[model samples]
Target: MNISEQQIWDLTNQAIDKLGANASPDMIRDYVEKEIANRHGGSLPTEKFEGRVIITAFGINKPGIVAKITGSLAEMEIDLQDISQKIMQNFFTLIMIVDITSSPRNLKEVQEELARVGKELTIKIYAQHEDIFQYMFRI
Candidate 1:
């Protein structure tokens, strides 16, 4: 039968206590480590993002629109991972993937600032985390 990691840890600790070997804390830890290493050679790395944001903006095509949004991101030291912008028949559309790992401002502040810029530029802007985007668009 397959046992969970927690179960293995609990059983190890209980056995140690019952045996009363006067084992040192380090020894116990090493034993557990060796046992886990033997059971599982190496654990796989998890997929994680420090911070990710998907932003979409649409409006009547005009100049300096992309500049305004990108300027805010640059000011906050946010990394622009990916971006796409197009203008067709005077309608502007832009989508961006932003990394906020080293940004000085939080997500809320960035959203608010983008909203303010959108109002000034007469465009609509929306931001959502990558995970939320995935969930909403999941099959």
Candidate 2:
């Protein structure tokens, strides 16, 4: 089904509600898939390894976290497709939904690279792909 940015944003917001700042990458990623599919729009084939990466970085929410993560992803040749930035007291949350069209590293590797940045900035990251969604709310 064709997806709109607003709808995606709304879905993203819903995910944020469930997956706070401390949540793992897999958590939010699953929401996007479940919500999209549960719309009764039917299952959307998760194209090859071509998936989306949702990066949740907490602290310095405005540009700092976003810049750092995006910059790091760029270094890894990962492209950003959509993003949501939420800032709270002394903490910034960057929910970046990225396109894995040209990801040079796997999700775990990408997470590893991100860990370095988080270690430096004290920001925690949770990274995951669309497939993780299937198991999120499974029986």
Candidate 3:
């Protein structure tokens, strides 16, 4: 029921301690993996987003920017799954993950509309597939 990454680390430590100081590294790793799998059924179910789009916007900080950006999504029937925005000095940065599978408009059309909005708002908006985001940020 929603265990955090830190909690998982703590639980792994406790499990390893129970195996005593002489426990091998491989044994500890295996034990922790199995314990976590047993608790969570190996993987957590997630909502599938076929047309997942990541949008990043940055510009001078001002009011109503969020409402305007999200309003565009609403008009297109796009689902805004997650969003985060921050302001540093007079600059504003926003990142949003949206589900565009159900949208009536195509990806090109959506990006074009967003570009129009960006120009109007004096902000730069970029829209790309989620896979690209994952690849570029992979460690």
> Highest lDDT: which candidate?
3
TM values, all candidates: 0.61, 0.55, 0.62
> In candidate 2, what are the lDDT values of residues 36-108, reduced to their tens digit?
7778557743434567877777755444666777789999888888888765785777788887668756677
Q: Where is the poorest 10-residue window by lDDT in model 1?
A: 40-49
Q: lDDT value for candidate 2?
A: 0.75
What is residue 83's positional error in candidate 1, in angstroms?
0.7
Scored by CA lDDT, what does every candidate get? 0.83, 0.75, 0.87
For candidate 1, the TM-score is: 0.61
lDDT of 3 by residue, 16-123 (tens): 678888889887887877776677777533344467999999999888889999999999999999999899999999999999999877788889999999998999
Whose TM-score is higher: candidate 1's or candidate 2's?
1
Residue ranges of candidate 3 with Cα displaced over 4 Å: 1-49
- Regions of model 2 farther than 4 Å from truth: 1-49, 60-63, 133-139
Model 3 clashes, total count: 0
Q: Which scores better on lDDT, 1 or 3?
A: 3
Candidate number with the higher TM-score (2 or 3): 3
Question: Among these predicted structures, which one has the highest TM-score?
Answer: 3
lDDT of 1 by residue, 24-123 (tens): 8887777666665556555322233368999999999989998999998899889999999888899999999999878767788888999999999999
What lDDT, from 0 to 1, does candidate 1 have?
A: 0.83
